[model samples]
Target: MVGRAEFVSRFGGVFEHSPFIAERAFDAGDVREPMTAGTVHAALTKHFRAASQDERLGVLRAHPDLAGKLAIAGGLTEDSRKEQAGAGLDRLSPNEHARFTELNAAYVEKNGFPFIIAVKGLTKDDILRSFETRINHNVQDEFATATEQVEKIALLRLTAILPES
Candidate 1:
């Protein structure tokens, strides 16, 4: 176990290392401690501090199209990926998968980036509906949405990183 000074230094390092995460870490001041192992807030604050928005979104943007891509490395936590996979979209019926493919393609074509959403606690239906709903957002609107999603994701991650005592 880390001593308080070491923990504080390391914990602060989590913020200094990544701007996106640092922003979130600052918001989670109540839980920012090395002792907060296993809590979602700490994990997110640490992870976000170390990752870029693109990297974080890449993790949140799980899809067959990105399955074989290496660019998404360092994008998301292992737990988040597992949660998203279990969300059942990967098991969508053939027709549904095809529709999703089309939508994914169109979204990428228009935005120059993949559609991103945090799938941690959302159902498959909600995930699909979110795709449809968010597709209509303009670039500026979508950017805001993405940031908001990131914050929400950070909160969820924090909960996991630091379970309530």
Candidate 2:
């Protein structure tokens, strides 16, 4: 078994600034030899899902607004930067940026947290459409949706760093 420190160091940011999830997973003792992306993702997400609503909301809120000021300022995490760039979020036209800004504000105002999506393999247009549609969901539903997206993002991050198994 990997030591707790090394496991946490490798997987700490899988949940977007939520290192406690990794710590909790390690403490849960589910990590075994020959760890794979799938197994790591499952263990991390198990603790994430089991966290309190407030804790989960913190995870959601830790995510930067899609294509917002952070992206403009190059303040996003490396994983987020690459994922957004992959979706063409880094090359937004002025109008597209404006629309994204508006949508981001509206979504955050309606829901307590910023909109979170996996972003991998999705186009900017696809992301915008999802943002527009999902913004209309009730707060409870939106919260649940954001939670799921966080899990998806974590899984993708894990897969990038570990074998699939």
> What lDDT does each candidate get?
0.54, 0.93
Task: Score candidate 1 by lDDT.
Answer: 0.54
- Candidate 1 lowest-lDDT run of ten: 63-72
Tens digit of per-residue lDDT, candidate 1, span 67-154: 2122234343354455556676545676766677787788777665666666766777887788899889897777667656655655
**lDDT score, residue 6, model 1?**
44
Candidate 2 at residue 163, lDDT? 92
Candidate 1: residue 120 lDDT (0-100)? 69
Off by over 4 Å in 2: none
lDDT of 2 by residue, 39-110 (tens): 999889899989998999999999999999999999999999999999999999999999999999999998
